[model samples]
Target: MALQRVLAVDDEPFNLEIIEEILEDLDFELRTAASGPECLDMLEEFNPQVILLDVSMPKMNGYEVCRAIKSNPDTSHIVVMFVSARGSVEERMEGYSVGAEDYIVKPFGQGELTAKLLKLGHMLLEKDILEQQVEDATTTAFSAMATSSEMGQIVNYIENIANIDDVTTLAKALINCMSNFGLSCNIEFRINDEQFHHATSGMCSPIVLELFEILKSKGRLHEFTSRILVNFDYISVLVLNMPEGDSEKHGRIRDHICFIVSVTEQQLLAILTRNELCQQQQNLNGAIAMISSKFKGLMLLLDNNRKQNEAVFKGLQEQFEQRIPTMGLDEDQELFIYNKVDNAIQKSVAREEALIQVRAAFSEIESDLTALSNKVDEK
Candidate 1:
């Protein structure tokens, strides 16, 4: 370690000698100044860590010198200890008020002087270490906050884009999200053999595009150069211009990108599936409507045929009653003819009941089809 620099300023030559002797055994580079003016002159080049100041001087006293040192930005950090013959409590308080770290009485023991200097040196070292730790902690906290903010934005954007049913619009939204983080990105989505692509600029390099395909097959996150590529089931996102030399920040960005891509892929797939199901439902509804129309036509034809058969049977019954009575048949023959006519009418009634049952069954079928069509429409 480098030696700690110490400047001892005392107007008395004998006092300076005594201070030099007291601190000689310590690991310090000592510079002595006979007056406050001389000390101020040496401070620029000496840049001592500690200043041993004497209060009683001819023109410029140690109190004035201490205040001057404290006021100057360049020399304010140096520790100033008052070494004076004036040892009263009032003198000590005055010394402290003037920015002195400690006040030592004149005729002090070698042990006391050495102990005070060593303690101040240790304090200075601890102060430096503590300041460094605080600085480092502050830096880490800011970094974490920044990463968290970026991730939050990514999640919110994914949610918003999920509501968009169009693949092209979703692709554009993804691009905008990446742009918000100051990243250049190229995205591609392959849904049902349809290709959709969006890029930050006009076009991405061929190498990057090829890598997007390769990474998509891998279905994971990959990093190369200043770019990171994340892949999902049917989508690939290429994030470019990532920061270098900061491993922590890079990892944060990579994780965020992967999560965003994964969620977006799921949403896109759901939209595509829903669209396909809707189309199939439409086709099914059309087929059902056509069958219903055909059944309705068949029902009309059956009604017409039933009415014509009834009219023919009635005519036959009228012909039997009129013609048989005119031929002078016996009573038994007339009764047998009436029985045959009644049997013909009963057979016609049975056929008409069977046709009505068939028509009722067709009507139930049509109701079921209509209900199914309604259910599909609701979906």
Candidate 2:
């Protein structure tokens, strides 16, 4: 478990030789492959716990090779680190998405490569120790709980979590589900931009929480000794004990744990999305209400203006008729002035009609907005 074996795969013979030369002093079981296919072929026989994969190999690139290795149940546990000239963020993310544990750029010094490997070596040793502890600590209860069928538990878990709207409730549901499988575990969930960590017996210890933070980006599934760390998006789960003595049960449990964590992550996302939508709906409702109120005020003001305009037109006609005879104006002059007053009154009537049309349009707009808000509420 001290990182005994390492396989370096590259298209360039010189690059492979350089890797070998750099690690020669570290006493590793070093091997080299000239192509990606050769590297895969060596996996079954050499079975190195770590792979130094070059990104730009011909035929099958390093990303593809890493994906293949991680997808295979037999070799999925092998850690992959990319050794490549492409050091961009996009390239590194691609490497991780395909199950590479770490990324190292080309022309790395001996000290850097060795130091990273040494850290991995420590991790392997810790994993071995954890495995032994799990085997030693496993009880009769766990063996009895391992009936090899987790479908029912999964079904119930999904049912229980489907309608969960709060992170605390969801966290408790997960802890209880794992307990049903006889697992003492710690779980971390990132919900609504908040982080919540829960454990079987109590809150997650400081060290366990730190481990979750460190291991969350390691991959979808990472095992150390007797524990497996499952991660997806904003969810991370650490199963405290795995049945080490029973390989068949262990494999089944590992798969089940992965599936369960994936479902939990999905549920957490659903909760977050649902909350966001609800907030948006509320905002829409508020906007509609405000617009409707403004429209109502405009209609009232228009109604008052229409009544005032009619009163003014009536007073002008009455005043003109009464003053014409008193002023002893010529008949032609009186008739001309009367015609001008009538034309002005007609224009005011037209404006009143336009205001009525404007009021109708405002009512229609308000109705449409109200209906849209109702639709959002239904969902």
Candidate 3:
């Protein structure tokens, strides 16, 4: 890691000496100034990460100097820590209220000063790393957005089309995007037999509508005078009032508009796909919920049948036990009949327990499915 810079501003020369002696052994590049004005001057070249300021100064106090440093965007990021003899609560509060990160007393230990500075240094390093990561991510996103050889501004606008969900907003966004190329445009988009129209200034004239109809019928690109019309299966874009004299510029503009329209048609397809997926998801969720409800009802019926079967088995076992002693038979025969009844009762109980477990398992699965369905709906 690079050495962090430290700027200490104190009117007292002895205090500056103390600070230098303590911090000189550490991993820092330290500089000192005798007054507030001198400190401000040194800040230009010595862009320190942390500033050790003394509260009492000659012309400008530490508060004033700290405020000046903070108000300027260039130097605002530097950390300011007050090192002064005024250790009262109010004095420390005053220092902090003016944007000081820390307040240290006059009789500070070397270890205390080193610990504070080290913490601040680590924090500044982390902050720098975060800022760099954000800048890099932004650069990558923009680069990905402009993969084609089109205007960067228009590419950015085209990239945002996937995020738009409403037709009216999409129309407005399209108009704004074309405005960057200095073209006055209007759009007529249709989806599922619903029509949406937007223009930059006034309502589109009847001639423009007629031109759109003519292009749609012919299924070809058309350029008449200064107006250009491009038609697709679902949408049409009309670029009007092109600069008439510059044929080269007009041709380029027309080509770019066509490219944009092609990309927009793909986006419209995505919108349609998204809508269809949402509808399918809704239908699937409803089906799952209905199945879950029916399964719960089945579980209740099974439970009732199991209870009735258990009661009948218990009653039969009781009757067999009560009549066993009274039956006139050999001892061996009586013992055999009792054993048969006991075995049948045990089998019945085990089967009922298995059914209960199966019902519980089904209930758990239904709960999981319901939760998953809700999550999909939220998305």
Best by TM-score: 1
TM-score of model number 1: 0.84
| TM, every model | 0.84, 0.60, 0.51
Which RMSD does model 1 reach against the true structure? 3.3
Task: Estimate candidate 2's alpha-carbon lDDT, on a 0 to 1 scale.
Answer: 0.89
Q: Please, what are the lDDT tens digits per residue for candidate 3 over residues 1-379?
A: 3337999999888999999999988978899999999999998898888999998998999999999999899998889999888799999888888888888998899999999898888778888899999998987676555434347766687779879876677778778878877889878887897766778885777776776666765764777788777888888988887768866567767777888888787887777877787997889888898988889888888888888888998898888779878888889998898899889878888988888898889988888988888887776
Task: Choose 1 or 2, whichever is better by TM-score.
Answer: 1
lDDT for each residue of candidate 2 in 335-362, tens digit (9 for 90 to 100)? 9999999999999999889998998899
Q: On a 0 to 1 TM-score scale, where does candidate 2 land against the true structure?
A: 0.60
Cα distance off (Å), candidate 1, residue 41: 5.4
Candidates ranked by TM-score, best first? 1, 2, 3
lDDT of each candidate versus the true structure: 0.86, 0.89, 0.83
Residue-level lDDT tens digits of model 1 in 1-379 = 1238999999788888988888888889998999999999999998999899999998999999999999999988889999888799999999889888998998999999888988898889888888889999998899979978997897789679867987778888888888887899988888777656779995767887777666678747777799788777789888889978988877777777777777788888878887888998989888988998998899899889889989998899889878998989899999998998899899888988999999999989988988987887787
Worst 10 residues of 2 by lDDT: 140-149
Ranking by lDDT: 2, 1, 3
Once model 1 is optimally superposed onto the true structure by TM-score, how far is the C-alpha of residue 110 displaced, in angstroms? 2.3
Please state the error at residue 199 of candidate 2 in Å: 1.9
